[model samples]
Target: MTASRPAVEIFANPRADRSAPRPGVLTHEARAEAQAAIRAWPGYAPTPLLDLPGLARRLGVAAVRWKDEGGRFGLGSFKALGGAYAVQRLVREHGGDVTFAAATDGNHGRSVAWGAKQAGARAVIYLHAGVSPGREAALRALGAEIVRVAGNYDDSVRQCARAAAERGWQVVSDTAWEGYREVPTAVMAGYSLIAAEAVAQMGAERPTHVLVQGGVGGVAAAICAELREAWGADAPRFVVVEPALAACLLESARRGGRTEIPIAEETVMAGLSCGDPSPLAWEILDTGADDFAAVDDAWVPPAMRLLADGESGDPRVVAGESGVAGLALLLAARERSETWAALGLDAGSRVLLIGTEGATDPEIYREIVGRGADEVAGTVAR
Candidate 1:
């Protein structure tokens, strides 16, 4: 199943029209259906979009809106949306009593494992060789069997794929390739509910811009498609951010096609690491994206520092490397003052960003960002 893989283009210093309109993404019916399905979770918690005024002032932006997915199901990441949707749909489609199984990079696997328990099923997750022991332990605590792969995330995904094929276990994955588009597509659709909620919460004061992190592009695809569809041509400008070392989406934009890379992607932002762009999401983001930016590991520590210092003057938020790195992008854009001008990001501009996860590996988070925010805060309060 070897195929043509293109080198990805990283969009930045964008030369294209910022306001160029794209086609509609999800339909009203599709959105409503997805919303209803999420509501059925019963235990679904309302993740908030905090208005980061202090952070916004620091970034020189009119406003910064954050969709904090920390402590989401006590899992500390946003992958719960995809994992949950994939499990429920898989069980219903194939007929099951509520069990799910998959390999993960910690967050996704745990999300699936947690969702399976909620859906009345069990999950076994596999991981790549280098996954931190802390993450493996966390996944196991969710009651998943953690299998180690020989290589990277995609490699573990392949192992999961083979296992699912042979054992008839459902693989709750976000990335899609040949002959396996439906469930992943559903996962993307499910994630779209996040942006939908953001928009709904904003109401008449919808965000004028969006900055989404890219892994395999499921969350980005969902947001881009939904923004275009729900808001039409006049919607907010869209931008994507990724780790400089693990920017597979940016590589795809360069090659003018979906590109595969060396996968030597060692970075603090493990959540945003992917060697290939999901084909389905690539198709949607090809021309729909406005810009792409890469943040170095250098900026993550500072951003993480800031995420912990919220409006409450306490370290209220905990995030993974990629999660906090998004703040780096927002701050840079605000500093450059060019993207802001180009996108008409004035005082009125309401911009949105995602805190995709909270410390997928607390030990790793402590290592990267200096003593975990949660720990330092607890110590301070005591």
Candidate 2:
């Protein structure tokens, strides 16, 4: 029997201080530097911004724009903009043969490995027990040595930190802690490119609401910071989404501070199964995000299928499990009139959802969507 869906937990941030200054780490100058650097690299085309008229009609919204990052730098995830860029920055600062290490459930590791390969450096990636073999293999194919850890993502992160420090390997983590700010700040700066690209693609037409998935809240914070800087008082309402099973950001928002939760169970959204909120990311998200929504894992498969099937005549998108979190949150929220009204979503609302990754794990994608990513992209016969 199919399992039942859980109630969607929504929390409105009481601390969305619009007058607060933007975080120093992700300032416009930092993004400019990152943009110029990243654009100079090979294969740096901006991902497509797709208009989903049919989806908008169905959802009672004026427009729905999807910033599809599946093809980002040919890495199949928006993480391509962050981890790799941070690695490159480190290589420039250190040396060509400098070693970098990171703990990841998937995409970020691939990005670091890819960056290391480009610079002829060494990459050591750590994965928790829950990460799929397909994801581990992807990192290995990118030329990273994989180390399996004992517990959850947070455990792997601790192990990675210890090992990196002992082995003299620079930790190129996407999540920032107390003392480890510079590298993660650089990572988030690179992620600011997503908002930059989206702003350019939209061309003065700004969304009323932007729903972004939160994994340690890095990408969401980056986007929130960038859009707030770009639009100032006219910034779009930011909604941070995550799996209910691992809603560290939401809990942090509710508590009015950075919070960490224990991961008792792993969600199918492997990329978002993080238990700890990044301290640096929290600095921006505390006041930048308007709301935090955690939706059940049961909503993911259907959302993925919806994007793949293009049920509304929209172009097909190969959004992975974690990639579809924002869409899942939207689907859940619309079903409840209270949530829909609370979010100020209506006939005139222009919604922006980022498809954060493609088929990062083809096996899981095929199992969930019943088709391969290439087939959905029309590259292979369906």
lDDT of 2 by residue, 147-262 (tens): 99999999999999999989899999999876899999899999999999999999989999999999898999999988988898789999999998899999998887889999
| Clashing residue pairs found in predicted model 2 | none
141-257 per-residue lDDT for model 1 (tens digits): 877777888988888888889987888788788888788887777777778878877878877877777889988888888888777777877767787787777788777787678
Strongest candidate by TM-score:
2
lDDT of each: 0.73, 0.90
Which runs of model 2 end up more than 4 angstroms from their true locations? 1-5, 380-382
Best by lDDT: 2
> Residue 127 error for model 1, in Å?
0.4
- What TM-score, computed on C-alpha atoms, does each candidate reach? 0.87, 0.97
How good is model 2 by TM-score? 0.97
